[model samples]
Every structure is written in structure tokens, then in C-alpha cells.
Target: MTQISINGVQRQVDADPDTPLLWVLRDELQLTGTKYGCGAGLCGACTVHIDGQATRSCLTPVSAVGARKVTTIEAVDQGQSARVGQAVQAAWVKLDVAQCGYCQSGQIMSAVTLLSRNRKPTDADIDAAMGGNICRCATYVRIRAAIHEAAKALA
Candidate 1:
């Protein structure tokens, strides 16, 4: 059994050390907010915050998490004291950024991470930060607008 701190709670997950953190979260912990798109980590569908940084849970092993705090989409709005995540979530809703809604969680995670560090990101910066997250609906235009809106709200 390995202990992982998830969403401000410590959980004891019983699985192989090599098991992906995504399965550990969804299967063992029942935190299904993190979706599995391409297990190769190229799709960014399994993005989560590990120690306040965006991390791909599908490619990350359970043993690698150690004492790091993992934050999923379910807790992103409530986890941050600065309300950056909440602002991003609000912008996403306001802009109707989700089409199929399958990849929105990952997109929001990446956006929150981006805005947390850079209060005002340029279009290029937004593209660079969000490039990994793929939305089959191709909502890139709205996603970009929401990011800008979130930045404005944060400002």
C-alpha cells in the first residue's frame, strides 16, 4: 500500500508501484474527474496538479507521486485560496467552452496552471500552454477567449 495525498486528503492505495496514478485515482479513490484519453500522455486528458504543477497522471507512476499533493478538476475551484481556479472555471462556463465536455477538465487544469503563474498571457503563451490539451470539438477560439477573460477577472 502506498500513501498519496489527493485533493487535500491522504489515501492509501493498494496497487503495484508501477501502476499509473490515473487508475489509482479513478479505480481506488473513485476520483473520476481525471479522464483517460491517450494513455501515452500526448493527449493531456489525464492532467492533474501535482504539487501545484500540471502533471499527466496517466504516464505518472503511483510510486513517483510520493508526498506530493494531487489536485483534480473536482477540487480545483475549492483548492486554491487565490480563486484563480474559480475564475477560470467561471470563464469556461461563461464562454461555453465545452462541446463534448470530455476534455474540458484537462483543458481547465492546464488553463488554471497557466493563469496561476502568468496573470496575463499572450495568445502565443496561451497556445503554448494549451497546446497539449486537445478538444475534438475544436473549441480553441472559445478556450482562448476564456483564458483571456479569466486573466481579466484575476487582474
Candidate 2:
């Protein structure tokens, strides 16, 4: 059993160290909020925060996590990231950014990371920060809007 820290809690996950964190989170820990999209890490559906940085869980092996803290969509609005997470979630909901909703969690995660670092991101900044996250529903317009609104709410 390997000990992994998840969402402010330490969990003993019985799995191979080489297993991708996406599988460990979904299958082992049942933290299905972090979805598996492109297994090759091309898609951002598996995005989660590792030590406050947005990372693709599909590409991150469980062993690589070590002592780093992992934050999934389930408890994003908690801990030190609370303020930004809540603002981003509220903006997402208020702006109705979800269509299919499969990629929203990753999008929100990326947005939260972006907002946490840059409180007021411009259109270019938003595009740059959210470049990795792809929304199949073509909700890019709304996603951008929500980021802007979230930044405003934070300000």
C-alpha cells in the first residue's frame, strides 16, 4: 500500500506505483471527479492541483506524487485555495459555463490555478492559462467569460 495525500487527507492506496494518478484517483480512491479523457494526457479532463499547480493526473504516476498534496474537484473549495475556488465555481455557475460538463472540472481547476496566481487576467492571459483545457461543448466563450467574472469577484 502506498500512502498518498489527497485533498488535505492522507490515503493508503493499494496500487502499483507506476499507475497513473488518474486511475488511482478514480479506481482506487473513488475520486471520480477527476475524469479520464485522453489517456495520453492530451486532454485536460484529468487536471488536478498538485502543490497548488494544475497538473494532468493522467500523466502523473502515483509514485511521482510523493508528499505533494493532491486536490481534486470534489474539495476544490476548501483549504488555502478556498477563495479562488469558490469564486471560480460561483462564476462558472452564474455564467452557465457547462454544456456537456465533462471538462468543466478541469477547466475550473485550471481557472482556479490561473486566478490564484494572477488575480486579474486579461483575455490573452486567460487564453494562455486555459490553453491546455479543452471543452468539447465549445464553451470556450463562456469559459473565458467565467474566468473574467471570477477575477472580478475576487477583486
Candidate 3:
């Protein structure tokens, strides 16, 4: 059994060590917020925070996780204590960042990570941090706007 700290809870998962963390999260843990996109890790749809760094869960092995804290979109708000995440979420909603919404979870996760590192990210910084996440709806404009808005809110 492989044990992992998901969100903030420790759970034992009975799966192959080589199984992708994405499957473990979606299939076993039922934390479906992290979507599977470009199973090769090219897309950021499966983005999650592995020890506070935005990681592509689809290509990460369950065994590799070890003792790292896995933060998903479901717990992005940190149960109301995540100021950065809440601000990003609020900005997303306020700016209407989502069109189809399939990629919003990953987008939000990446945005939160970016804001955590750089409280005042410029357009280039936002683009660099979010370049991997693809929104089929082409909502890049709103996404960038929301990131700027979130950064201002955080400031």
C-alpha cells in the first residue's frame, strides 16, 4: 500500500507504485478536480501542487510522491484559509475566466502557484507560468486579466 497526503489527509492507497498519480487521485481518491489532459504531461490539465510546486500529476508516479503534500483544486482554498487561492478564485469568477470550464481547475491551481511565488507578476510572468495550461475556449485574455486582478487583490 502506498500512502500519500492528499489535500491535507493521509490515506493509504492499494495500487501499483508505478501507477500515475493522476489515476490514483481520480480513480482511487475520487478527487476528480484534476483533469487528465495530454497524458504525456504536455498539457497542464493535471496540474497539482506537490510540495507547493505545480506538478503534472499525469506523469508523476504514485511512489515518487512519497511524503510530499499533494494539493488539488478541491482544497485550493485551504478550507477558507488560503488567501492567495481564494483571491485567484474570486478573480476568476469576477473576470469570467472560464468558457467551457474544463481547464479552470488546473488553471486556478497554476495561478495560485504563480501568485504564491510572485505577488506582483507582470504579463510576461503570467504568460510564462500559464503557458503550459491550454484553454480550448481560448480564454487566455480573461485568464491573464484574472491573474492580474488576483495579484492586485493579494497586494
Which one is best on TM-score?
A: 2
lDDT digits (tens) for residues 105-135 of candidate 3: 9999999999999999999999999999999
Model 2 stretches with alpha carbons more than 4 Å out: none
Compared with the true structure, what per-residue lDDT tens digits does model 2 show for residues 23-69?
Answer: 99999889999998998877799999999999999999999999999
- The reply for model 1, stretches above 4 Å from the true place, is none
Screening candidate 1 with a backbone cut-off below 3 angstroms (N, C-alpha, C), the clashing residue pairs are: none
In order of appearance, the predictions have TM-scores of: 0.98, 0.99, 0.97
RMSD each, Å: 0.9, 0.6, 1.3
Report the CA-based lDDT of candidate 1 relative to the real structure.
Answer: 0.93
Question: How many backbone collisions does model 2 have?
Answer: 0
Candidate of highest lDDT: 2
Model 1 reaches what TM-score against the true structure?
0.98
lDDT-sorted candidate list, best first:
2, 1, 3
Give all candidates' CA lDDT scores. 0.93, 0.95, 0.93
What tens-digit string does per-residue lDDT give for candidate 1 at 14-118? 999999999999998889999999999998889999988999999999999999999999899876634989999999999999999999999999999999999
